[model samples]
Target chain A: MKNEIKIFSPATVANVACGFDVLGFCLDTIGDEMVIRKTEENGIKITKIEGYDLPFEAEKNVAGVSALAMYNALQPDCGFEIEIYKKIKPGSGIGSSSASAAGSVFGMNELLGKPLNNTELTNFAMKGEALASKCEHADNLAPAIFGGFTLVKSACPLKVLELPTPPDLFATLIHPQIEVKTSESRAILPKEIPLENAITQWANVGSLVHGLHTSDYNLIKESLTDVVIEPYRKQLIPHFDDVKSAVLEAGALGCAISGSGPSIFALSKSEATAKAVQLSMQNAYSKSNIQFETYVSKINTQGIKTL
Target chain B: MKNEIKIFSPATVANVACGFDVLGFCLDTIGDEMVIRKTEENGIKITKIEGYDLPFEAEKNVAGVSALAMYNALQPDCGFEIEIYKKIKPGSGIGSSSASAAGSVFGMNELLGKPLNNTELTNFAMKGEALASKCEHADNLAPAIFGGFTLVKSACPLKVLELPTPPDLFATLIHPQIEVKTSESRAILPKEIPLENAITQWANVGSLVHGLHTSDYNLIKESLTDVVIEPYRKQLIPHFDDVKSAVLEAGALGCAISGSGPSIFALSKSEATAKAVQLSMQNAYSKSNIQFETYVSKINTQGIKTL
Candidate 1:
């Protein structure tokens, strides 16, 4: 087996529009780089972390927590060392913690000669995710691991389905540098929603999945609506409606808050349109004096890759 | 255009498992037959009825109501007369009323030289459906018009999507000879449902649509679950759990109440398995002394067809 491996783990957008907590997709060009080394000694350690101020303790850190979970289960003959070169920002709502959580296990699994499947890896990664978000979730991690679009069909059983990615679809994301805690964002949601609205939400999800499979752009545009989540969560993000309208006016197929808020993502049929969408989002928020970063990329079909 | 047309409008299984009020499919070899004839008279009429006691008034009967809806929209050069050969029994929960409503507009549109498309036909059919169910719904009508599996993606400004049908899939339906009114079933449901359950429901719907598009039987089985409406509505059906267990034990891919209830449907991977599922459903209900009718049929890719 290889003694070490360097890999790229992609960022992901969870709670995709009408999908709420169930759907997410990965980005190809945006993510974190990690190096996993099979150490001579006997335990897991976070040797280095860069780009952002984060904990280096193995148990307290997201990446270390995930690596430790997998290590404890496998009981490998050798200890491991992890180095995270972070690029995705925390509290950005584009699944920054998930990228960290998934990258560690993915790199370690490769170093261990691929002992675990995506589902098994996701469970371990979710353990790490829970530490950061206060709840175990797979929507972000599944896409970060499996690539493309993923549906966390059931949380308890942890069923994750990898949905198809339309060939021409490109995602444009704008992250307004703002802190929107996942827990507080979750608190504002109503415990119960009208049954009629629920039906509309599911119907949109059903059609959206179909749209992806068939590469029907019109259907995707029509189905990319969130009646259950966005109406409430949009309140937390400044210029949410303006950005959404701007992207739609820029010819985006669909647009919505990426995960919880602060970051917004829009899907368009071409790279040109995606870039145009980025400019529109820029225009929408630039005047508001909110510092932001934008990215335009195709759907990542390969989750974590050896570098 | 033909002066007269005789058509078979297939019975549909709506509220399909996880896709409440959104998903449905047409069943071959099971439906109602109607003969629609263009007449010199400038109005619509229901000339003959057979096999059931039903209203013959042009505006009162579902077929007449749907035909009149289309007739009024077109104000065609001629009137039409409809003769019903109703085979799907009313209050059977197998979209009996939808079959009738769809059949008339389908036959009338044929005689009128295909003036309108499936979406237009669905809109007219939903009007008649509203007369029977006291609500405008397209789950049943959409599939009956579009053929195969369909998702009623939106109710207002009705957008219906025709989803791909898996080749090996077969349906087994059991209609218990008991009354389960749509309104009563609707009354039993809570106006608001837990947000958590709604998430589960939409996740299943998203996966189920994926499964159908990819023809993944295992994914289909896993996704064929209803967490929102089934729990409350299944109570109105006799021996719902017993029959479900029986069908699942017989190697059926999935099972759920067809539409509102009293009728249950199971999907299997093959015609043989579907027949076996029917037998299992028979055995489950046979001991209870409930009069029932069972059917095994492939998906009707051709919705309303000429007889």
Candidate 2:
């Protein structure tokens, strides 16, 4: 087994429209690179950080915390040092913290001769995710670890289902430089929802899953709806409706907030449509004064990859 | 075009566990038979009704109502005469009315040279379903019309999706001789549900659709759970908990009220397991003071079939 491993852990879009807290998909273009090395010492160390002013303390860093969670469980004979080159912005709502949390465990698992499954790795990554977000949901980390589209079926045992991705699916995302905390986005939600809206949401979720499995693009377009959360959460992001209408009018399959806020993502059937969707989003959000960055990515079938 | 048609319209188990008012599957061994013929008259006529005391008048009968809905729209230059031989019991919660409602549209479409597609047929059938249940829903009629498992993506526009059917899947259903009115069963549901519970319900719905597409029996088992509707509706079912426990112990995939209740349905992976489940349900519900019937049927792939 190799004593040192480097991996590319991609960002993810969680709470995928109708799926709410249970579904997410990985992105191909934007990610963070991490280097994990096994050392003779028995303690985790955060050796370096670049591109962002993240904490240097082992326990304070998501990568170190996640690596320590895995290391303490296996009691591997040697310690591990982690270096995070954070490319994803922390509050972009594109699962930056999740990338860091999942990348460390994925690389460590490889360096330790692959002792853990994706489900087990997700559990450890979720531990670090909880430290960053005050919640232990696998929706973000599961896709980062399992690749493609993943459904976090149950959180108790951390059952993450890997769903098939259509070859033609492409995603266009716009991350407006603003902070929308996950906790605040969650706090704005009502404690209860009407059962009628719940039924509609679940119907959308069911059809969306069907669309993914059969590669039915029309079905996917029809099912990418949210009657529960998005109605309220859209208030937090600037020009949410304008962006959504622009992408939809531009012939994108669907558009919704990426994760909790500020970052918005849309899915299209082809790269050309994705580019068109990106241009539309730029036109829609350019009216706002907030600075933004945009990207187009294919649905990442391999979650975390070795460099 | 054929002047007359004889057909078998299968009964369906709708609201499959977590998929309340959205998902349903047709059963092979249980259904209703109908004979439809083109008449020289200008209006639909209910010529015969046997095996059940249903209204013979065209406007009052489900079959006549559904056929008239289509006939009125098409003005097909002729009238239709329908004869019903009802085998499934009314108020059994096994889609008896939906069978009658869908059968007429399906048979009329064939006699009219298949002018309407399944989605259009489902809309005409909903006109009849509304008369029987005081609601315009396609949860039951869609599966009875389309065959196999179906998802009612939208009700107003009447989008009924034909989902893939895993070949080995079978169903065990118990129909106790008790009346649980569809309206009353729906009345018992809370208008507002906890957002947390709603999230769980949608997660299960999404995962169950995934399970059906992938044919993953374990995923199906984990997902056949209802956190929103069953808890209240089960009260109208006799020995619901006992039957569910017995079926699960007998290695069934999952169990829930067939539609609105007194009929409880359990899904199993194979016919043998379905039979075993039927026996278990019989044993579980035998202690009750009500007369009941039990059946084991494979999933019917073809909806309304010509005889």
Q: Candidate 2 residues B1-307, lDDT tens each?
A: 7899999989999999898889999998899999999988888988888899999987888888888889999998888889999999888898999999999999889988898889999999999988899889899998998899999989988788888887889999999998898889988999999999998998999888888888889899999998889999999987899999999999999998899988999989998999999999999988889899999999998988899
Stretches off by above 4 angstroms in model 2 are: none
Candidate 1 chain A — worst ten consecutive residues by lDDT sum?
A154-163
Which tens-of-lDDT digit does each residue in A1-307 have in candidate 2? 7989888999999988898999999999999999999999998998999989999897888888888889899998898889999999998988999999999999988988888998999999998998899879889999999999999998988888888899999999999998898889999999999999999999998888889988999999998888898989999998999999999999999999898978999999999999999999999988989999999999999999999
Relative to the true structure, how large is the alpha-carbon lDDT of every model?
A: 0.92, 0.91
Give the TM-score (vs. native) of candidate 2.
0.98
Per-residue C-alpha lDDT of model 1 across residues B65-125, encoded as one tens digit per residue: 8888888989998999999999999989888999999999999888877889999999999
TM-score of chain B, candidates 1 onward in order: 0.99, 0.98
Which one is best on DockQ? 1
- Backbone clashes per model, in order? 0, 0
Cand. 1 Cα-lDDT: 0.92
Interface RMSD of 1: 0.6
Q: At residue A250, give the lDDT of candidate 2.
A: 99
